[model samples]
Structures are given as C-alpha cells and as structure tokens.
Target: MSKLSLAELVSMVSETKSEGILRPTTSKDTGRYERTGLAEVVNMQITSGQFIGSRVPEPTYLPPHWSAHIHPEGQLYFCRQGSPRVVTEAYLYRPETLDKVTGWIKRIEKLIADQDFPVSAELELFIKLEDEDCAYYLTISAFLPSFRFRSSTCFARNCIGTMSNFFPMHGSLSRGTLDSLVCVFMHAICDQMTSRVSTFPYSKQDCEAFVSLLKNSRDHLSDGNIVCTVARLWGIICRNRYLTQYGQENSRLSRDQAVLWDPETKNRWVSTVASRISFRTSDRYLAQLDDVFVDHLVYSDQWKSMVTGCLRDWRGASHGAFLALMLHIFLLALTPCPSLAVASASLFVASLLASTLLLNRYVPLQGVTAEQAMDYLEAVQSPTFKFQFVALVFALPHTLNLWGTLVLFANCIFMLATNFGTGFAAGISTVALLAFIAFQWTTSDRFNLSLARTHDKFRAMFFRNPDASYTSEV
Candidate 1:
C-alpha cells in the first residue's frame, strides 16, 4: 500500500468533510514541531496540500500535523478506564489561526503536566459531539477507582456507597466510560515515563518490567523516539475485543477470532490504520494530538481490525438502548390511572435496577464463554421462577376488602337519604374521613420504617461481602 504523506491525507480529509481528531505521538527528530506537540482540530481541515512551494503561507490557524472540526469553544475532555479518576473537562481555546490553536494546546499540556495535574502531560486528540440529549453520560463516570473524589457526600459518591455499584463494567454505559479509560491508560503507560507509585498502586512485577522496558528504549534511541510498543499493547486489547470479538466469546470463538493479537506469531501487525479508515480530530486545544503519529498509533497491523470493529460495536450498542429506555420511561409517564401509574413506576424502577445489575455482571465476562454465566444469571434473576413473595398490609377501610365495603356503604347511605334518617350525611362524612385516614396511615413510609430498616440491615451485612464469599467460606 502506498503510504500517504501527512499533507495528502489532510487534503483528502478536507475534501471529504470528515469529522474526527488527529493525534500524533512525539518523536525525537521533531524540532520546533516538538514544542507544537500534539494538536486538536475541529471538523475537517479547512484546507490541505503541501505548503513547501505554495504561495499560500501555511494557515496560522491550523495545528502543525493534526486537524479536525469541533466546536472550538467547547471544553477538552480526558478519560481513562479502571482509573479512580476518569472524566475531566479542559478549557478550550479558539485561536486566530488553526495552527496557532494547535501550538497553544501543546503548550497547555506541558503546562498542566508541569503543574502536577493528576492527568498525564501526554496528548490525546478527540472531536466527537453528542448527537442528541442523552440520559446516560457514558464517559469514565463509572469505572474510576476510589479516592478520585474528595468527599463521599455528593450524590455520585453516595450512590457509589458500595464497590459493586462503583463500576458498571458491562452494558451500554461501559464504552463511553471504560473504553476511554482503557485508551487513556495505554497512552499514559506507553508514551509517558510515569510510574505506578506516583499515581496508582502497582505490583513490583509490572513496575520493574515497565522500567526495564523504558531503560531499554532509552538505550536504543534518543531524538525522542518512543517505540510503538504501547500502541501495540492497546491494539491487542482493542483487537481482541473488536475483530475476533474474542471478548464476545459467548457468541463466537472461532480460530479466526483468536488469531487477532498474537504478538508471538509470524503475523506481525502493521501500523496502517489511517490508510484503511477515516479519522478526524477535535479543535479543542487542550486535547493535544499529533495527526501523523495518531495515524500510526491506531494503525497497528496486529490489531487494527479489532480496534475499528470494537468502535463500531461500542457505539452501536451504547447509544441505541439508552435512547430506547429514555423514550420508554417518558412514554410511561403519560398513563392515567393512579394505581396503574404506580404499578408502572414500580416496573420502571425494577427495570432500571435489573439493567444495572445485568450490566455489572456482564463486564468481566466479556472474554469468557458465557453459557454457564448466562445460565446462572438467568436462574438467579428470573423473577417468575424465583421463590419470592411480597406481603402488602392495608389499614382499616383501605384494604381491598374494606374499600369494597366502603363503596357499598356509601351507596346504601345515598339510597337511604331519599327515604329518611336525619344526620345521615354526617355519618357518611365521618366514615369517609376514617377510611381516608386509615388508608393514608397504612401506605405511609413512616409505617414501613421497620421493614425498610430490616432490608437495609440485611444488605448492610453483605455489603463488604460481595460474591457471597462469606457464606461459602463460613
């Protein structure tokens, strides 16, 4: 395949009106360009083609090697999966020229890194916008490890009271959050010489291995030549999940799928990603990216197919269900009958809970055959077949039987009023008041405090003992 010069590729993207972010990795030989670092573009390049002999001066608004079309004023977003802190928004800059904007972004990255921001100084490029209002925000809002938050009093912190609910590993919510994290982690580990101690707790094995790898890289090259090893690692994860869908082993696990990322084999992966697929960068300067390197980074022969496939699947699966459920809930609210409305409300709440649990359970099992897992999940969650019961107690006159009696009594009073009986209206009024009071008392949350307490206490006992390990161990 003919390799594309950066300018030719940029020209093509400009012509196509593609929406993407260009991310390039730093290399040793890049000089003044090095300070320009990574850049973000919005939409497609406003213009393209070689500037070497062209009378037109290189567009000052354009970043050096990266371009994309995004709202220049929007915040820069950063994320990583499995890390305690995932989602972040950086200030966006609108520069006089696209190139200047790109330079400023790189400078900001260096500035942030120097300031000791928790995030890596390294660059990532992105240029995606939410197509519509969504109920679920998918970015690494879920999988971030503990300690990211300063207080446990906020709504999200309170919701994450237990670790089980902390990460929605699988489900529609997984991708925007977890996938971003995965990419972030790979970029940090591979491109930056950060250690686990400064950020996350790491095992000695991984730390030593990584340090040794870094040392070896330093020995082999200088002008800032970092190997694409980290990119290769990312390719492995992405491809395994994407191409062979090994991660979807529950559905298919053919030998073809398993062949996606075997570094040990003769099938050495190539870095030809941008050649095969269309990609663009964001204009958000803080999300610095180098287009040329990003092309190479994403185009690992070892796992390019898998990464692209994963993107397709993640996007398709994430947004569709979120939209459907939001619509369903909105529609359900229009129903009229109070009793029916209450029932629908209960159903909605139950459905939401069930979805959360199911998503949590599916995350870790992505790479495994899910026959037994699915069976277990179904068996445990099958409401119809599960042996369970609910007892509802109604106060006097509010009970189904009592309510029927009141209806009959009211009818009798109306019938008798036509005949005789002084003070009949008063009697009927008293009965009605008594019935209302009784009904209210029975359903009152205050009356159910004990029941709520019992449920809470029971769950509390199992709080730290997720997986029911205590029961088995005991």
Candidate 2:
C-alpha cells in the first residue's frame, strides 16, 4: 500500500484552512524534513463526508506521534486518512516533495510575523473514497477564526493556556485571542466540541453571513454592529458551555444577524446594553445577586492576580494591626505559664511568620506606601473583588490568632498544669498533625462539591438536549 508523506499532507491542509490534526502512518520509516523540521512522522486530522461542519469533530487518537505540533506554521487543514484517497484544502505533495512544503512554510511564517497581534486559525480536513478501493479523493476546506483586540489588558482570555489555571466567571463571555495562552484555552475548551449542526466548508448562507458581519463597522459608535457583537459573545459563551457540558460541537455561526462583529465593538455593546437600565432599577436587580456576581468576578484570575500583587501591602497592614495583640497575649501568658515561655514565644513567632508569608506569598500585603496600600485595600474591598476579599477574611483569623493561640493555649494548659512536659508536647504535636489532615480533607471535599454543583447548574442552564425545544432567554 502506498502512503503519503507529512510534507505532502501539511501542504494540502495549510492552504485550505482545514480543521483537524494530521497524523502519518508510513509503510516505511520516514525521516524528518531537514529544512522545515516538519515531522517525517505524519500526524494530523482529516475532514470528509458527514464531517462537514465548521466546528471540528474529535477523531481517533493515533498514538505515539499525532499532535498539534504538525501545523506550527499558520495554515488550515482538512483531510481524511483512513482510506487510499485523501482530500485536503492544502496542496498535495508526493514523498520527497520538498519544494512545495518549503513554499507553504515561508508563506505561513510571513503571515504569523506580519500580524500586529496574534491569531488563532481554524482548520478542517476530510477523507472520501473515489472508488470502492478508495483510489480517488474529493474535497478539503479551511476556515480561519476572526480576531480582534478588546480594550482591556485581560491576558489570554480564550487562549488554551488560560484554561489550566482559570474558569469562566461570567456567562457567555467569549474572549478575543491574540496569543498562545488564548489558543491553548480554546484548544482545550472550544476546540474539543463535536459539531451537531452543519458541515464545514460553509453553505452559501454561512459564507454570506460571515462576509456581512466582516463588512460591518468595527467602531463602538456604530449601532449596526451591536447585535452581531452581542450574538457573537453569546454564541461563544453558549458554544463553550455546550461543548464543556454535553460534548457537542456546532458551527457558532447563526442565522440571526448578530455573532460576527469585531471583538472591541462587542465589549462596548455589552456595557451599553447594561446601561439602558436605570441605576436605581439596575442596582436593585444587581443587589439581589450582587454577591453572586461579585463572587464570580473576584474569585477569577483577574482578582486573584490583583490581590496577589498587593500582598506586601496587605501584610504590613495585617501585621501592624495584629502585632500589638500578639505581644499583649504573650505578656499575659508569661505570668500564668512561666515554664512554657519558650514554647509560647516559638508559637507566636511561627504564627507571625506564617501570616506574613500567607499574605506576601499568596495574597501579599506588605511594604507599600500608605496611599498605595489604602488604594489596594479599597480595590480589594470593592464589590467587584468580593471572592478575594472573602478569602482574605477567612485567612486572617486563622493566621493571626488561631494557629498560634491554640498552640500556646495547649502548651500552657497541658505542660504547665499537668507538668507532663514531654508527653503533653507529643500529644499536641499528634493532634496538630491530625487537625491538619482534617483541614485538608474538609477543604478538598468542599471544593469538589462546589465544583460539581457549579458544573451541573452550568450544564442545565445552557446545554439542554438538542432535541429539547428551547429558545434563548435573552
């Protein structure tokens, strides 16, 4: 049986904007492409009959070699590799076809570097049979995602890299990607969906819709694009939610006039939409679920990073407030438990160090000027920053008082009263260890429960069965 080379397949995939990863199963051992470093090993995806939607379908994993690395250069792909015939939007090359691959590689390199910002490309590949033996092939098509910059410096919103560390805090918030992190996030969340709607290689209607949206004004001042931006944002949010919840993938394009405007325009539109409501009325509605909204926003990476950056300032304030209390406690213990002085001091010192480290390392609060310190606190204290604020409060009492006070209290009660110094010390140590274990168990269990519930609710809200008749609420 004759097999196609990696260069041949990639050439076909890149030019067509096909969707799917490529993989090579060679009859002979293939060596690396010396010039381009394209894997001699062929590993990619193919789009063909029945897989015609813009959203890519998850494919069979060809172990050992198949991965996203094949298409490092920007291009699209669509190929079906199971049979003798392969259809790719990319130009096909034969084994030892170096020039074609080289030409395409240079073109992709230019596109990647020429962009003022970053881009995430969507590719599709399909495989079909010309004859019963699969002697001939048919079509491969590629579609590239539209990219735009949001006014905010929100890092890696829809990128793949962000998914590992964060979850979406807002409903239907789709990020505009311009970097690797955003790509990674999309790859993990959006890219993994199974399309239930239409096939790839858009129908005339899909193409027309995309073109119409593309032609619309990019400026926020224009009202024409507002609906499209809102739809696009909702589509992104809904699409991702659908994918994560029910593993279904559908082309995000909708027949509705909305869902295709510039990203920046969309952000402005959302604020404008929210602003239509009077503050008196809006504030009342917001106040009812304000805690929920604040919790989601503050617990997100946006708030996490903000609080973490200001940890030093928080530490200084915390220490200043609690240091006197600690010193007073130490003085009081000294008279009642003279023999346990060293233990008490050790506990107090450890407590302070732990508190300082928790603030500085986790949500640091130390060393800022009074103004910056106060400003930082105010920001954290804001309703928009509620989750971090809650976390900070929960942490304070434990770090400042409980750990040290409990330890010192035990030392005084056990060692001084019973005079069973060594035995009591060992018992306290054992109990502390057990307490730590219990803390870990409870914390992990609670987090797991909360996560499970959140996922269930998110799924129920957005991803009812395709057969289930429903309409968009807003």
Best by lDDT: 2
In model 2, the Cα lDDT at residue 472 comes to 48
Worst 10 residues of 1 by lDDT: 388-397
RMSD to native for every prediction?
26.1, 23.9
In model 2, how large is the Cα lDDT of residue 447?
72
Error of 2 at 406 (Å): 4.6
Mind giving the per-residue lDDT tens digits that candidate 1 earns over 314-362? 3443344345336445444443333443443344344344334434544
Q: Which ten residues in a row have the lowest lDDT in candidate 2?
A: 161-170
Relative to the true structure, how large is the alpha-carbon lDDT of every model?
0.32, 0.36
Model 2 Cα lDDT, one tens digit per residue, 1-474: 234342343344334432222232121111212224353444455566443444454553322221221222333223332322122222232322223333433344353344322222222112221111111111111112332111111122342211111111111212332123233333333322433222122233433454454334233312313323433433343333432333334323321112223222223443334334221222322332232122122112223334553454446535643664466565565545554545545555654665565564544333333334435544544443332333434344234444456545665556444555667667767887799887777677787898789977877887775235344433
Query: What TM-score goes with each of the models?
Result: 0.17, 0.27
Q: What is the lDDT of residue 144 in candidate 1?
A: 29
Model 1 clashing-pair count:
42
User: Using alpha carbons, what is the TM-score of model 2?
Assistant: 0.27
Model 1 regions more than 4 Å off? 1-61, 69-107, 116-407, 410-474
How much lDDT does candidate 1 score? 0.32
